[model samples]
Target: MSPALVNNSVISDMNTQENSEQRYRLLIYNYLSHKTTAEEKEVLLDWLKQSEENRKLFSDYKKIFDLTVSSDQKSRFSYRKPEALKRLKSKIDPSVSDARRLKIKRLKYYLQTAAAAILIFLIGALTSFWISRNQSVQNLSITKYEVIAPRGGKSEVVLPDGSKVWLNAGSNFRYGADYGINNRDVYLEGEGYFSVMKNPANPFVVNTSGLEIKAFGTSFNVKAYPEEKFVITTLVEGTVKIEGKGLNLSLKPKEVVVLSKESYEIKPDVDKVTTTSQLSERTGRDRSEKKEDISFSKSVQVKSNVNTNIYTSWKDNYWIIESESLRNIASILERKFDVTIRILSPELNQYTFTGTFYKETLEQILDILKLTAPLGYEIKEGIVVIKGEQKRKSIYDNFKTN
Candidate 1:
């Protein structure tokens, strides 16, 4: 053959191959849209199995078709699929030879098919970008902030609303970045002294495990230790309301409400003060004092004189115990010093201690307790074991008795 004829034949083969690929792509679109004939479906499947690239191209088109259909349904697009396909087919030229005209006609069909395919691809890309952007916006709406006062430590945090929280030892406080905007919400564990900034429209809410204290521009002390049986809310400067389990109590300044697991009680006399030293003397007494029964009456009010400073002074790092029990003091020391305290003597557990210590070492506090009470302590392996006066008998004594 001549060189010119050979080049013409090669060009013709290339054009035929391109026409076949264009027809295959259109068939794939029809197959995805459930508009293909049985023979066309068989041809599409065979072409997909011919090579990995062909399979990938079919897969990509199918994904775009499904995404576009779903997104169009959600967005309520005005363009119908049949109308789009019909409008695309009307623009083909028909005035050529039979075989060449068929090729050109299919070529025009390929361009129209590409227009719809590209439209669906762009719609899917825009939908994905919109969804991801919405998710990013939702994530940015609220930012969480947390403050922890570890054992033997105290911390102060000023919230976004200019409210100040003084966290005592072993306390956790958390609030969100949108704190003052809609409403001021804070979660508290253990104890916190809050001086809330007043916002009449957006009330402040302090949440504990048992109850919630709602306040507006008020200062209060909350003692909600997980180990303790009572949630104590003491109002210092402003009025506040405590609510839990269908019970509500409105508290005035210098008043305190104590919420137990089953009931709630109010102590009216915040001034009646008893020191822990006075209670310590009564520790070794008879049966009645040993059982500290918590009153569980819903919304029951009782009058007792308590020094309000004793409850709120921990904000100043002062631990004031007027008449607190040794068992209770041990619990406080455990959190304050971050140490385990074991009262070996059951009798010693009932003993009470009363004192005030600011920035005192655990050893220093223990030394003071030894002087004031019949208690001996041994610090071993990160634990303080308090022993009573009755020492254990020697093993030789049992042998001698035998």
Candidate 2:
């Protein structure tokens, strides 16, 4: 027999199965055609309950049938059961051995199984493609917004969650559109005073270059200047948790945590000092090698009587300097005046000045420095040059009266 004749004989044998089996096959066909009567659906449900294999086979056949008869394929090629049967019969030669007919029956089974497997693979591939495409769209929907305070300028911004932020001169703040909804996250460069709104469930997080500050309904000041070697976080109200390198510390009201760029000698009596051993324990490093490899020291939590206003007064348009070095003072003036300041004398850099300037011009502030410290400043264009003042000799001294 030819392959088509043998395949027809196999189909005939399937139709000659027990009544229940034949009814099950007919129910599967009815489901594929979407024309199952209520009684046929009930019978199919009972058959599916007999075994897991039965349910799986039925599902695979249903998928294959749906794919074959889909509208796109139907428009291109009309498939009719009678036409398919006629084509098979016309192609078959009715003179062959039984052995050849058995082989043809096995081939028909393999072809049906392969077709079902291919349809399943295609469905899975399309599902995965759509899932990835939707994820990309979601990522594109998240927009990032950045606010910058120019040199000698200060800005105030309101976040999407109604939190208020005061950005100091030369500061930058950024947040995304999904900030409050998914996560209240912000990145800060330079200084910012945040008055966070209380949402205990979603804590507000402020990320600096080296530290992360998590706060809940709190007001705090973060000073992390790129030029400076320290990142200082001061909590004025509520509470905040600070994390950096291998340190995690919590701050209360009027508490300050300082993160330095250099390792310092650990003292026994210091307040909440994180030692090299503690760092090694957290980071899984040899204590000796850890110290040398770590650029930033463990955070130092200190209790001081120093006025907090000196650190936070800049947000109110006031510069409260108290015994701060001229080098540090010059840094402030540069930002306040939006000008470049060069100190010619290294000795002058250490001279400490204490005063408060409110709405003062660059020349006026420079004059105040001259009287308090033996420094002379000259401004040409936008740069200010500061040098030590020279002393004048008296006429008697010049004549060598002694």
Candidate 3:
């Protein structure tokens, strides 16, 4: 089939960059039309040498070739059915027919010196394109909108505005093309980071669970799951306005908001101190415990969120889940791990699972889950069977026993 047929929509107003792609497509179309010359083959080799990506694109297109072939008796058309493809345009319009016939005549006239050996093939192929055109009709993960990674897998998606998003296993984002325009809107069901494009005119908005975040070009993390009671939004940079029922909270960089149907809680940002203090009494420092004074500064000169890399690393193909819940963790697990999960109890929905594990393989992720909660699991091939148990701090305990 011609590149024009398969790519007519995208090709109609293609720019200069697409012209080279069109040339390569044309070469393939001609080669498949059984009109490839030994000299043209050498030219194709030279083009392939110019770029490695070109070779891969050509190789990947071999699938199109495999799908187009119907029979062996009609061996004259070696590359899928050219006649079917052409006929698809409009019953082989007379203009194209005449063009085909004339092209054949001209080729014959030029090769009059060596046309006798494969006489019938040369004649049939001039008309083969007309034949292929007639026949053979045919035909990310869980995230804010609708997402869940396929089991044992994860994915990374970059929005049009240069903002990066990391989808956890079995998680997916619901972001169609209508992003970065009127609203820069994204609906994520699981967990994701927003390294937003600075657009004062268009504030980025993310909706998950029952909470919504409006940002002014910032970076942040949001975790919302079916089993969890509250939606958690953690700001890592800039500022984010989070809203929920009876809740309108603005979080500064490094601040976090926990919103639930019953109540909303805001956590103030604490100054970061060394988890282990080196300047203690042993190090000749004052042993006074009078309310420690510390300050958490932004990674950027201006006050921004710390943990920028840890927060938005998934966009760069890294999975870093902080203290999250089973309800929320399941959502992130789906995207980074690429699998499906179910919350057996709606009451358990808000049961938070908090741990920090590097994003990776689905099995390894599930193994980490076993360690974080009172749960047992078995992995056979691609399927994982999870058995949940209640712990003293169980989020699921609030609901009735099964």
For model 2, give the 10-residue run with minimal summed lDDT: 104-113
Steric overlap count per candidate: 6, 1, 73
Which lDDT value does model 3 have at 204? 84
Question: Which stretches of candidate 3 lie above 4 Å from their native place?
Answer: 1-152, 176-178, 261-378, 381-402
* CA-lDDT, candidates in order: 0.63, 0.65, 0.51
Q: Can you write out model 2's per-residue Cα lDDT over 1-402, one digit (the tens) per residue?
A: 233442333234544447546656656876666666555566577878989989987888788787887453353234234434533563584342221221100011111111332111111112212222434646565556666665666666656555777788778777775679889989999999887879999999999966689998988899988887667888877889887655666766766666663433332333223442333222224333434433344445344333566777777677889878899888877875567899998878877889998866777788898876667888886788999865512332455576
lDDT top scorer: 2
TM-score of 2: 0.55
Off by over 4 Å in 1: 1-141, 262-305, 391-402
Arrange candidates by lDDT, highest first: which order?
Answer: 2, 1, 3
Error of 1 at 240 (Å): 1.0
Instruction: Write model 1 residue lDDT over 1-402, tens digit each, in one string.
Output: 243442333223435767767677667776666666656566667877899999898888888877787431453224234423433454453321222211101011111101232111111112122222333647564555666676666666656555667777788776765678777888999998887877888889998965778999887899898877667788876778877765566766766666554343343322212111122111233412322321234223322334566787777666799767898889988877667899988877766678898766778888898877767899876688998754333342455599
Model 3 local distance difference test score = 0.51
Q: How accurate is candidate 1 locally (lDDT)?
A: 0.63
Better of 1 and 3 by lDDT: 1
